[model samples]
Target: MLNGLKTLFNKKSVDSKFGIALRSQAGSYALDKGEDTDIQAGEYFTETSESAGDWLDDLLSSHNFQGSGHLVLSASHYYNVQINKPDLPDNEIPSAIKWLVKDIVPIDPDEMIADYYDSPVIVSGTQKINVVCSHLTSLKKYTDSFKRYQVDLEGIITDEFAFANLLSHRKHSTLIICQQPFEEVFLIIVKEGQIYFSRRLRGFSDVGGYSTEQLSKGICDSLSLEVQKSMDYFERILKQTPVSEIKVLLPVKHENFIIENLDKNTNAQVSKLDLPSPFEQMRNCAASVGGLIEFERKGAEND
Candidate 1:
């Protein structure tokens, strides 16, 4: 059956060298703990009759990215759960979003496939948790897209972690607004070297989707709105402190809006993350190169 072919093809494949290049733009940096590098990468999912290893090998060959020891963290998801008394399994801990915004919004717990990882918090007594989940079918489709791109996926990583890695080097509270295809917008808030929160906005691009110019406009507007919203939420609800500075990283081209808007709004420092260092200019695929570099750093530390 076609379903079996698909299941058979979804087996995990490990590469020791590159660790799996994430879906990233050329020259996009992915910081693992702290080192930076250029990367050429893509993301895809498995399909009927397509073995993950075969698809990955073909992708590497076509793209010409080295793949000797790359490893993809496939089928990975992130979610947050508080460290409550251990009566039930940790899985019993409800979604972090549910805990934070339960009164504000009702979420169908079963609808999402959630996972969690513990992280250190700024306060010594408390712990920060990252919760990641997505519609199961949707997650699979995301993976499949990488397979479709014919790029060998060394591993799978959540977009949140990717964003986290991108912002790891930054200090002070920071906000990241990214405009994806179809006018989808993602707003991330980070502080003390970790993700504090995030929000997504849809249909903010073109009415139907995106055109080159329309996407540019959407990026500008979305960044402005998300920054305002993040500032307000941090002050009013979280009641801690608002981000002192905001940094915007774009794939290029539309970077002007990020600069212009920041200049117009409250005094927050806004700039591009993609070009943190001038060396980033030399690489064509920054994210992929960043991925490889991050992997290399981790590998080196382990040894």
Candidate 2:
């Protein structure tokens, strides 16, 4: 995902554009023509090796992603940090605050592609914003490939925004946990269709391989602690109202076991996320499928 490239969509263009989810090991595609999106889409993957650059050309060179497109870099490729808003003009925010992001992510500020989304007013009436930082060298590998192959890159997003798009507008906040197989878990809170908070929880990448036996053995109880910690920060620290719902798009068969345990242990209700239409069926690539759906707003709003 690159900065300063985004498009507003028309109904017909949804079929022409492509949505891709790029991870360390694989790339999955989705088209928004209603049902059978999987039939219309394709993916490029490699398991034995850990390369991510030109191999993408094999996937991008096809007619699949021809026009303007959107891409969701999986959680491993990027990170989000919520910090106090900098008192600067919009044009200066990137340079002024990228250092702040560096303090948290440990990357050289020059080589990081950073962007921000404003969070809700904190309980103390202080303004806050979330900064998404990606590696410039790593991200340009894919974007340069897109340019060489003539795919007009529109917008870049993460699974946090992609998965949050599935929720229907609600009066109260809902926290959603999402993962695709070996990817890190991402937690996001949405209410009335707006993203209020997001976090990337480490470990648990192999949750997709978890069996009924493993979940029943309580391998996922630490997940409750992560969920509770996030809820606590949102309620007690941010001073926001308590989130009452928890949904998951984790794409595992035994996901229910984790959900059941979370429901019993955590403060809010927990359930498996009910993805919409085409995404619901392709649970593993739900975030890529969601890229086909238009964003409620740009991921980096300060731009």
Candidate 3:
């Protein structure tokens, strides 16, 4: 009976004006509505529910959601890894990835759901493939939650890929460091729309409270070391040219601190991420905003 609900709720239809970007922070959920690239509304929920039907009822009644659209998920729920491209047929890639990642993934292979993104570039006859894995139980839980509300989940994407989609227009190699509220930070390197490297670092708040100056200094030192390592690997291992600039996505309150500190320490030109007009006041929700941008781009290509 529940399986029927799950299957029924998983339908994804591309023709729509609205999209939803859903992400979990701490114990709550953040949902945003996007009409094309413009954000129309956003709401946060704190209540936790074990019953999907009850949860959906509450969400629908409270938000007054009117139409079905794409649902973009958060990266925290899945494991994203990069592995050497395997020599195999396209149809057999999924099985091969399962076997390769069995020991490394935290969950059992039998209970895992896997997906992959192929790299746009082939270097030295080798390619990099991004693999995303999630536990079947968690997948079912979230799917069932939305299924009860009859929300069509267009696709599941990581925050990294969403950010990559957000910056697809750039022509040169660049590094992106995104720091969200709470204690989450991601470092990503991209060139020509392909991700070469990515890492999530421990934030200053994760360790303990600190003065503004101390926190700024800590982030600067940590970013400098990681940025240097990524640059070295890009040149030495990937044999690619160095990145021309580093773009940091941070809260407006700490933007100056990161920019000033990173500028003094790194050779690359450091700057803040440019947000679209709709997102000018809500820099903190970049992941969700990026997901909306990505969905619109993909939907247009298909049209």
Candidate 4:
């Protein structure tokens, strides 16, 4: 019932791709066409349920989104984790680990739909992989809404992969830090343009709104430590080289302060990701913009 939740396409899709980055109380619809993009954004009623789809229905109508598209869900919609890759074959791993991680998630993993992506290549006994899952019943509200709005739901990706798509792939590893509205801090290491490792810092929802006092009083320090520690795990545990760069893409006002903080505590050079017009205006939808842009983030051929 829940399929195509990840990047399963191996070929080009000619039809228009509608990429929407969904947050708890609002979202942005992005349609990227090489040189130009048309973006529409709206906020949901504060008192409504996120799964009710009324806000999404309005957004799609406003965009006139009538074709297949990808949905990049925010942290609140799904469960994401890193675990030892099961010894089973690639095709069988999803089913096996679904049961393995059932305990961590609130949903019945047996009934929930799941997908996985490769972690960094560990030259050791067992490799690690990242698993993402969403309950089918809860996800249906999105699919059903798409059907009603005439927008074919092509696929769904977590916010990690969505942000990863915004980067230009380099041979070396790059760690990215991003945050959507009211969502926790997300850290991802993208190696060779694909997701190698990802983490969501709990209790950090909306760090962008942290006041100058909050940032000065150890919040940025804590964030720097968290990022440094994550990089350490990737290098020491995964047996990978130190990351080449660290990029921060956020909607916060004190971007330079965060960058400066990370720069002081980390070996990698820190900087902000450059965003174009619409994206800069609607920073909350950067993931949706990532979802729309065709960067070779999944190791797909650019040709």
Candidate 5:
């Protein structure tokens, strides 16, 4: 009953001619006007919980985001410590991280520079929070790294925001699977283009390092868990409307089989997400390329 209404509303929204919302990720960029694109860029420098800043700086200096458009550096490994059932007042929310860092995270919170924002909590009436933490030197290193590549860095945005931006057209509940070559799988739930939830699952890989048989089984099993979690989240917490569709975007090679297997695992229609064009289609430039499109779009709107 409610699902029908939501579908009708989504259809109406599409029919109303609202502009397409655009989005970019670590490896892909997509919009409503046309096809989506993938980018092929060289390795992105990454560091674990306690790495030195030089490694990250070296990574940033190798690429370019200037003139490409609006680009966001969505560093995924940040310590996103969050508490749901907060007993504090609304304004006091800022201190939540300070308290968390002191007791929760492994590294010294003071040694890391952190920024936080409040998100509208769709489920519980509790306040929702997002925190981004990185070493202060690491921030400078990232900036210096871009300078090394001679790519003009426009601005930085968190990955979650970028993920939400791409799915803006979804009025009915939707599930998005974001796969990077060696990183964990990211699952995002979109309702009417609003992000209801996001989570990252570790130990997932798509690189050719694994044996063919292992890779096949791994892809299917990982996707299976992703589908299950998406369903569980929709039913147990969201309870707004069931996910009407699931879109899988795998940037690695031989992902077709994985995508095909995903369709068989879930009732929600599954399909590979397409790229917009040369920007996305360019060789080995997925993440950087998508970042460029988004950067350009935001610049145009502001102008």
Candidate 6:
């Protein structure tokens, strides 16, 4: 199933040329480009028409940009689940997952692209594998949107994996709570450089016409409960090390309020998420930054 999808772009050398990384949400898109390890340029825009292809053309043409490269799309149209590692050959794992999640997933197995990440740790001959699936129809929509521009898609990755890539260098167990405008908050737990658990919660973003204090309180209350649940599950169900710290990534305007409120509610030390050097203004572009980092890491591995 998804094994073929995962290997679709491997036939090409990732470092042969430069590429563009794109993240879209709520009719808006952000484009990023880098040469070698340095990000040289970035652009953010909103679509005014139904045709995403037309919008992309206007953006690239307006900036006089040209070249074909890998496209990394940041989307939430995927599902992540944990399952026990089956006692089967590597080639049979995909079919096993299809059968396992056929009823769990809304769409038919034939209409989905599926992949999985085996837990870095193997305990008692059992492994926790994170399964990721995206609908074929949604994938086609994204591929078709960029095909008009002759862009080569490197991969379509979920925000969790992209964000995990951004935090790949961290050696400690940590909980990351990311609040994005108009999108569900992503609560991810990472341990030993791998995603241990992940969940998404709604009602954490801005409320139209609501006061800043009111919105902050609502977000803090909801976030507090989710954070506590994640911590308890990590320490009890997973029986792993306790998370050392809780990192919150949100818009700069809400950082101070969130820090103040979240600090009072959670035992873990809460602080703003630190961005990599090239992402100084990444408050609203966290996922895009992560996607760029993931793309670069893949390219380096290929090289």
Report lDDT (CA) for all predictions: 0.47, 0.74, 0.64, 0.74, 0.51, 0.63
The reply for model 3, stretches above 4 Å from the true place, is 1-38, 41-61, 66-75, 120-125, 203-210
Q: What's the TM-score of each model vs. the native?
A: 0.56, 0.84, 0.82, 0.86, 0.68, 0.80
Which residue pairs collide in model 2, if any? none
Per-residue CA lDDT of candidate 1, range 253-286, in tens?
A: 5456556666576567776666324335522233
Query: Which 10 residues in a row give candidate 6 its minimum summed lDDT?
Result: 10-19
Candidate 4 displacement at residue 68 in angstroms: 2.9
Cα deviation in Å at residue 251, candidate 6?
A: 2.0
lDDT of 6: 0.63
Give the C-alpha lDDT of model 5: 0.51
Model 4 clash pairs are none
On residues 22-48, what C-alpha lDDT tens digit does candidate 6 reach at each position? 444432323444353434435455553
- Give the per-residue lDDT of model 4 (tens digit) for 1-303: 124553332234444566777776556667743335444543444446744577777777766775455777888788887788887888888678788788877778656888777765754777777778887786677767777766666677778878888788688899999887777889999988777788889877767778878887998888888998999998998788899899998778887888888898888999997655566777766877776653323224434
Output the TM-score of candidate 6: 0.80
Candidate 1: how many backbone clashes? 52
Order of candidate numbers by TM-score, starting with the best? 4, 2, 3, 6, 5, 1
lDDT of 6 at 252: 49
Q: Compose the digit string of candidate 5's lDDT tens values, residues 114-140.
A: 556554354676665666565545445
